[model samples]
Target: MGEFKPVDLFATRRDWDENPREAFRAYVGSIEFVQAGKRGKNGADTIRESSAAVYISMFERFMTWIETRNRSFTSVTQEEIKEFLDLRDENGKTRLTSKIRMVYVRLLERAYEHLNVDSNPAKNLAVGREEPFRRGKEKAKVILKVDDIQRLMESLPAAPAWNENSKNKRQRGWETRRNRALIAVLIGAGLKVSEAASLKLRSMKPKRVDGKIEIDLEIWDGTGTGMKHTAVIEQFAVPEIETWLRELGRMDLPSDLVFPGTIDTADELSKPTIYRLITKTLDLAGINTAHSGGRTLRNTYAAQQLASTNDIGKVGEKLGHRERRATEMYLDAAKKFAEDAV
Candidate 1:
């Protein structure tokens, strides 16, 4: 008898797992989520990113509040939601804008569903709250010039030790080197902090073909807990990127994670550790993330790509956006670049 490959079994059972939700539920059940739900006072809420337990707890609280106040779910109308929004301003918490109101309204909609209401009062609620400020007023600020980026990187050769409690400097070591590389990659590659952390060792491979070596990035935005493929590239011209990959010895194993935590013992890097890397690197460079952040890197990538080519589609594709229209800001910058050059 020959050895059976895992792919053969998968091929054979391909039709067996047709219903994705059932398969997912089965997987979740296998992982004890279903059992945990059973143990709880009520079945899982499975709404508004709330767990069944949280839903039950909240529902219990809501019931108590309504009963004590002699109120009904029907009594809560759209006007009440509007009144709540009004109170948000009265309480000096004016940050509750239309987007936030929509979220609150969504929560109320879910509440109505759970309460078995005929209609969600929040449905007719208009998100007419004027943005606290105009889009012009909230324009993105350029935090780092090309020279500033260079100087900042030159300053932070390693992550500095900072005492969270005392707010003082400490010692630096290999961990410092690793953190520096992580930050450099985020800025150089314009990767999200989470994406940088989740980076696999194999995905950072530098391919050599016909005596030419080019670095590549294999991006993944996993879907439904299944590993998702986002972008693949043979682009980017940063020497430090290749140097860091070589230094880390992650040039071979595609399955291996790139920015792995020293203490994780897992395949991929921890998100918190990556966040700390960003903060520590910024602190060492004396850069404030208020302006220069992971998001800034993303925006920079979009802006630079757009300016260089004046093609929104190409930049959008590179940035993993499904729509070119989504890259309008980048396109707008590219247009400005064209005008400025002329």
Candidate 2:
């Protein structure tokens, strides 16, 4: 094991003038020690420099809040924690999304445990599930319609232009094939952006189901922390993926990343790159990409599945959701659209 370098929490503190930086530093150091040498979900040591930096930033923010109120970390109450989160949301300092709130709560819980302080103030604080179609939110209808999806797919290049031999032309050719395959997998297989980005060539296998050939995609959920599951791509998408694979072979590119960025030799495409590709494709297809990006494809898949099968459970399964209610929003939206059509 490599020597664990201590994180400098004070260096990342943003509210140094209003808060006692030393207090946050000590609190974060104690938490770091408690988490040190622990095995993470990925079977590696829990303590990482990147994770430590993130933890310090979150803790520093919270401790700054406590200090501004002339309160110590050990003196905080459940009500105060809730108020802090509310302030964070209201001030637009942070969106206070469920995921962000959960991170904050986890930090508090773990910190309390490390401090041997009973009655974790952040315990039982509800961070609601993310809703796709929340009422009164103009952003609810983010999913692309089936026709829009078809048009978007159609706008993409069928194959690389064969005659363009320039360096830029060759790069564009590879990008087109890669991006098309990336979008096909996202929409057809209903994979999350992270899942699609992390897909490797080895994760895809050709299989025979009922004497019919199909491509089984091994998707790693929760950034590879969750269990690996296989999702068969729709027949419509197999051709594009196969073409992309052939292009990769022709270029003598590494087969490690199914969709490698132009400069990404690490066998992975970043999420932002995937988002930009989807947005650019949508724009080229004459569809509005505002407030809509990669997740729209996944949502479109879920909506189509629900509309066709009228089964929430099945839609949830197709979307790789562990909970049935995760599919409910799509069902609700589908029903509402149907009624509006009447």
Candidate 3:
């Protein structure tokens, strides 16, 4: 292990007053102790990536909560901690279990050790009681509602007209097509961001069904199952996919990746690139309730499918989830949306 260099996390808080996300990532990643954690059967049996995701995700949600309400993290107290974790929707039986809330409090304690903040608000915090009749523990999904989805779709840049043949216009046209397709595949098909990036020309099978186009995604490792599954891109996003396919065909690139990568001639698009793309897209659509980049979009797909079908097994299969519990994570959001419509 390399020597852990301790920097004052908020020694210059103002540096990130205008860029909270970047600062949060920087401080979190810089802490080496937090990353190593413990492993094996003796030491909590936790994997680094999975463990990191838990704490990092919890902290990110806290930051987003602050940002969304136009509040700063300058003087966050125990009261703020309580308010954030105590969040509950209308029926009060949300999927956020006691374990999840406990992790939020714990991560804040570990994080504040490096922060320049006054005191550790989460040092002895409690997440309060879990609502009655809670199911098994899982991360609470930041699922977008119908209006949010509509706004996102409408916000996607339209295909540029053919008459604008200038160099800049042509460049913009290709980017617009690529970005639009990326968003459509994520929200429309519910593919993981990495899975969508790994897509090749062969993965996509477009069919004209009764005068409407639908895309079939032949995924081999979509859910880490090794088995293959064919997920479809819903009709609402067909036009954007079509436009991207045409533009990609024109490039005649050496790589067959559906999206542009670090180098089009070879490597597939990087995960970070896809993450940033989705983050920017979400910001443009005015969505700040979640942290992960394309997760909200993928969750939207799950919620919508659950709402429309009301079949847990079918939605799980479509998402390439091997277990029913994995798909059930979207149930609270799905059920809420369904009930709201009535």
Candidate 4:
């Protein structure tokens, strides 16, 4: 599908899935969103050019985060919506004021409403709405509880049956190990989804330091941050990462990619594939959550680091955040969880 030109932006000629990129083009084209923006709080019937650009910019930035993390609009949950704002606030030059952040929640809610999504995660997130969480008291699903995190680590999904597919039994073995390692690295390294997708074999090399498994995973948070940092995985996920490395080498895959799509192709895992893996892991751990994705693990990792150091600055560094302000929310969360325990 081609970019919908001026006149064609308003019509829904085909299903949104036919061309999601194209559909977003229609969304940002200013016709549909203009209608949405006109009705929200403090909204004017006629939008200024600069004002319209604000909504477009919001969509563009949000979509960038979504695509970077290998997620889609339909798959985004309240957890992701909050995480995007937090990331932008952390990485952007200017701070996102509470008022502006509220606007973000409203805009997302409106667009999702217009697009006919199953549920609007952004709904009632902002404080002005007339729901239970409207005053912002809703418990966010940002990180797994400490108990749940323990459960998740203990309940790694089992490998597929070797005898079920006799000819490809070995393939199943590596694939299972591959899946387990992916989850371990995610929890241990707290990697962004794209970073995980783009990971290479050499990135985790020098995997052992002084004969102990200390994977020095390097990550560059792409999308204009232009920063590189290392996450040291010492003991949390050592065994799984070790097992996966062995299986990955034995597969004889042509690609250097640590997590390739298949044995034959060098393609990175798709968004849905990563999403499903996270979901299945959570399910196996018997953790009930509305949003089950990598970001929760990312949050868990941040919290774990914070617990270890009791230092927001150090946690921010471990999380590869250049600005300490970006980690303020995590600090707040860590404090709140501590208080709950008390």
Q: What tens-digit string does per-residue lDDT give for candidate 1 at 145-185? A: 45445655776554443333432222234355566666666
Candidate 2 per-residue C-alpha lDDT over 1-342 given as tens digits, one digit per residue, 9 for 90 to 100: 235335444333233333444544454554355443244444554454554566677787887788899887777888888787667445365445445665676667765554455676765553332242123233354666657767877977566553334444245556767778888888777788877877777777764463212333444321212233556576666667776676665565544777776533565788878888888888888888445577788777776667767978655665666556566767765664455435
Candidate 4 regions with alpha-carbon error over 4 angstroms: 1-141, 160-170, 207-226, 337-342
For model 4, residues 12-111, the per-residue Cα lDDT tens digits are: 4243434555565556554455556644335633444444556667667778778888877777888887777665444464345344566678777876
Candidate-wise lDDT, in order: 0.48, 0.62, 0.67, 0.66
Root-mean-square deviation per candidate: 13.2, 8.3, 11.8, 12.5
For all predicted structures, in order, the TM-scores are 0.52, 0.61, 0.55, 0.55
What does candidate 3's lDDT look like per residue over 108-185, in tens digits? 665564454676677656323333224334557777778877778887756664333443423546766687788878
* Per-candidate clashes, comma-separated: 5, 0, 0, 0
Q: Name the TM-score of candidate 2.
A: 0.61
Worst 10 residues of 1 by lDDT: 1-10
Clashes in model 2: which pairs?
none
**Cα misplacement distance, residue 208 of candidate 1 (Å):** 7.0
- Residue 216 local lDDT, model 4: 40
